[model samples]
Target: MTHWPDRPICAFDLETTDRDPRIARIVTASVVVLDGDTVASRTWLLDPGIEIPEETSAIHGVTTERARAEGLEYTAGYAQIREALCEAWVRDHIVVAFNASYDLTVIDAEGRRLGLPGLATGLVFDPYVVDREMDRGREGGRTLQAVCAAYGVTLTAAHQAEADALAAGQLARALCTRFPQLADLDIMTDQAAWHAERQRNFAEYLSGLGRDASDVDPQWPIRGIA
Candidate 1:
């Protein structure tokens, strides 16, 4: 499997220590590689340097002692994940996520924590933003489950990293099926252009509702938006 598919993609998700990407550490992460239609995957549980908060633990269920005994030591696990994601990115394969900014930011922050470089540079696809753009003028939406329902994709396990990523990737496929607007995207789509276009569409949609979604994503110094 040295060569990739015409639609080389990977659906991935990460569980972290907190909500803030700058400080949150990765507790676990998974990558489901997609070669055209077939899939292969690998996942990792890591010993995040900090104690996992009960609130987050309640969500993903990795406890302190359990992780220390069972999970890979933080540095090695982090390095492996970083290497895997970077390898995929280098191959021009797109990494798909639901709310991509949150996950990707956490990854970057985690890299700094582990003394490793960022895994993904710019090529990524986000189903959440795509759904919002497609369902403009609709009310009571913007969640992964909601979007999946809107597109007639069934919801499986929610918040489980691997499940969510797989669902998001499927949702992306459905969107391309119905909309055909996002068919050309890949994991290496430059964040600057990607985020800018998404910001524009989202802002207009929100303004139509007299609300502001401008601050939805933190402004980062993206390398290649134009």
Candidate 2:
């Protein structure tokens, strides 16, 4: 069997208006394509048209004023993002995202908000879930920065979409190097099962604590409006 890293991968990431993926507007996005070592990237900054709260702006360094002044219109920016992802998939590259669910969810939501058809995020690889599954006993944080550190991949610009996307691709390469089984797994099928199992376990845990788990989405890669 061939190593997954030998194939093309489109690593994606988004900087958003807030933490809620369902409603948060995309402030910036990056799609980094990796074929072996050769790399190409596309990035976008968009005016979300909603006020970016200072607290959220502090994270990705895109204040509402700067966004309005320098960024593309939200619809145009999101259209470019969608087109890039579609082009990557059409080229047979699997889309890779750090925590795919959140990023993809934002994409789905944004597309719907713009009255565009939902994008298919089925053929996607999520290093975050794969790492958690493969190394269940690993201590400490599982954030992009922490995981990159664990894999000896330097993540220079922490919250920026372009830097994060490139780092995610590098991290995926590291994981595939460490666990050949991960490279063999079918992301569309096997990963859906894995994500469902993870969600089920999480829901059960929440249920034990008397918290409602009914709204927990089991969708892998992307989640649409519930």
Candidate 3:
């Protein structure tokens, strides 16, 4: 059997309406399933049950009209996305998202709202979280682009969901190699625990930012490139 480090994994990314996974609809999603170090990829464009705002279209370039015309229906798209997430989990692949909390929570909430079950993917790797844990004493905290810069990983085609997924995967792999200790930590975190840790980190983080704040925690954890 392959080692955990070499195990099957899913590197995923989503482009959404907003940063809050609860309110944001997944406009597009991509999953790259990796066996060992080799990967096979899948991507979907979705009609998110709401009009795509002009600003969002400017970011990801998928207009509401275009999505409605060519993209899969919201229900069908969610079903397909859920199937991929569940399958990836059952196969023992880590559901890798650069910041997993927002995506997983969004998925869980969306499935429930749609009368479907939660993602069978029991675990997730937030490269951002993992990077923060590993590089706690380091400067320039763990944004995907910044982490990629620190690790010398190049990000191509910024704002494109599929490209962002691949780039995050590259950073995830590099981080694992650079800090093997993290792979040994318990990555099977529940939403509440993940949420708690993020809140704690942000509060501490904002103290560093010199911002006057009652609390630095935003209700949402997925910062950018949702």
Candidate 4:
């Protein structure tokens, strides 16, 4: 059987105005397509239509002033980002993200906010969920940076959309290389099941600690629309 990373793949990442996907506005986004030895990528910087909070700017290095001057208008940039991903899907590329739920949800919410067509759910490979399933007993964080390090992949610019997107593609390839069994499973179905199970386990762990676990959603790739 052909392994996933051995085939064409598209990796995506986003930097946004807030942590909550339901309310967040996209500030930057990237899509990286890898096929054999060729790589193609597109990146977008958007005005987001609101002042980016200082803390969020600190994380992504896109200040309000900079975004206003250099970024594309939100609608134009967002449309392009959506089109890129859709094109990759049409070409049968495996779409990858580090934590797909958040990025995909950001796209979903933004599409609704702008009255644009939503990105249909497609074959998605999330390294965050895969790493948890593959190495459930490993210690330490599963941040993209940490996972990249663990897999000997270099993430040169941690929060930059293009860098993160490219690194996610590399990390997915590395993961599949390490665990060939992953290629035998159906990405959409198996990943969804794994993510749901993991979310349930984490929710139980939180409940045992007497914390509110009500917000723990098991939805994979995208969360419920708000």
Candidate 5:
């Protein structure tokens, strides 16, 4: 059987208007297809139909004025993004992301809000989760930038959707290469259980520290769905 890294990869990323995926609006999105030496990518900038908060704009460098002027309408742009991701899934590509729960949740919530079909989640790979699992206690920071550095992957543009997506694909490949046993795991079932356990542990840690762990969801890939 071909391992995940040897297969085509469709990595995704999003820069949004808020940290809460339930309420966040996509300001920019990217889908990067990496198949062997060939790479293809699509990116979208959406107007989000709401004010791009100053702090969020500062992070993504997408001002509300620029987005309104140059970005596609949110619903339209998001529809195209969903279509691209669905096509990737249809092609049997492994869907990859850095912190997948956030991005995928944003996509899922956006699809629901826009009345579009939901995303397929069976073959998803999150390098963040994988890294946490593989290298249990060795982390300083697990942010994409830090993980990229740890894996010797160059991330030239940190916040740009296209750059982040591409780097995530590279990071996923690097991880699979280093941890060859990862190929033996089932993406859907094993990853779901692993993520749930990881979240539960985190919640317990928070509770021990007197922090509310209620917001720490145990769902993987997507959350808050009924």
Candidate 6:
């Protein structure tokens, strides 16, 4: 039997209007299924219902005009994205994301806005967090592109959702191979708890600096409703 880490996993990513997960509309999204080192399947969504700001479009290449002409309404577009992810979960595939917190939190906020079902936080694998925890203090940067280069994974089309999603999947596979701990099933089971501890630690550090820590959420993969 294939080890859990080497099996098919779901890699997801999103391109949005802005960085704030609470309000950004997803302009493009990709769900790429990876089996070990191979990409087995892929899905893409584009033209999310809102106006795409020029700055955002410059980054992701999806313009407001293109979105208005081809994209589904915001609610419907999100529904499609949600259904694809939920189905991946239902099939026992771990959803892999580069920086899972941001993507999942954004998805959660979008869910709240659309009245859609929220994602199960525990079913996620975040290469970014795992890398940071296991290989601390070794980096100049930790963005997806940075991490990919660190892992010797090539990431073409840096901000494009499908390319990013595919690269993230490759990064996960690479990390699992390099760090045996990441391949274990326990990573999935302990993800939420781990994030809680991480958040608490950061909150404490912030508290020492006189910053409020009460609002820091410990929710890992998917933040609770906005």
Worst 10 residues of 1 by lDDT: 217-226
Best candidate per lDDT, number?
4
lDDT of 6 by residue, 42-143 (tens): 555556666778898899888888887777777777888888888887777879998787888888888877776665653688888888787887948988
Overall lDDT per candidate, in order of appearance: 0.72, 0.87, 0.74, 0.90, 0.89, 0.80
Candidate 1 lDDT, 1-226, residue by residue in tens: 2322235778878888898666778888888887776888888988886788999998887887777788898888988887887888877787788877777777777676657655446366777766665666778768888888888887677777777777877887777778664544442343345566767777888889999764555343222111
Question: What C-alpha lDDT does candidate 3 achieve relative to the native structure?
Answer: 0.74
- For all predicted structures, in order, the TM-scores are 0.79, 0.94, 0.83, 0.95, 0.95, 0.87
Candidate 4 lDDT by residue in tens digits, 63-86: 999999999999999989888888
- Order the candidates by TM-score, highest first: 4, 5, 2, 6, 3, 1
- Least lDDT summed over 10 consecutive residues: which range in candidate 3? 217-226
Residue by residue across 1-226, what tens digits does model 3's lDDT show? 4455677778888888776576788889999876765778999999997988888899989998888888899989978988898888778777778877677767776877787765445567667777776677888856777888898888887778777788777777888899877666655543335556767776777778986645334333332222
Candidate 2 minimal-lDDT segment of 10 residues: 1-10
lDDT (C-alpha) at residue 187 in model 4? 71
Mark the regions of model 3 whose C-alpha exceeds 4 Å error after superposition: 189-195, 201-226
Candidate 4, lDDT over the whole model: 0.90
**Which of 1 and 4 is the better model by TM-score?**
4
The parts of candidate 5 lying over 4 Å away from their true place are 1-3
Q: What does candidate 5's lDDT look like per residue over 86-157, in tens digits?
A: 888878899999888999999998888888667666589999989988888785898899999999999989
Task: Indicate the worst ten consecutive residues by lDDT in candidate 6.
Answer: 36-45
lDDT of 2 by residue, 1-226 (tens): 3344566889999999988898999999999988866999989999999999999999999999999999999888888999898888777787899999999989888888889888775368888988888899999999999999999999999999999999999988899889887756665687778888999999999999999998788888776486
Could you tell me which 10 consecutive residues in candidate 5 have the lowest summed lDDT? 114-123
Model 5 lDDT, residue 214, Cα: 88
User: Model 2: residues >4 Å from true position, as ranges?
Assistant: 1-5
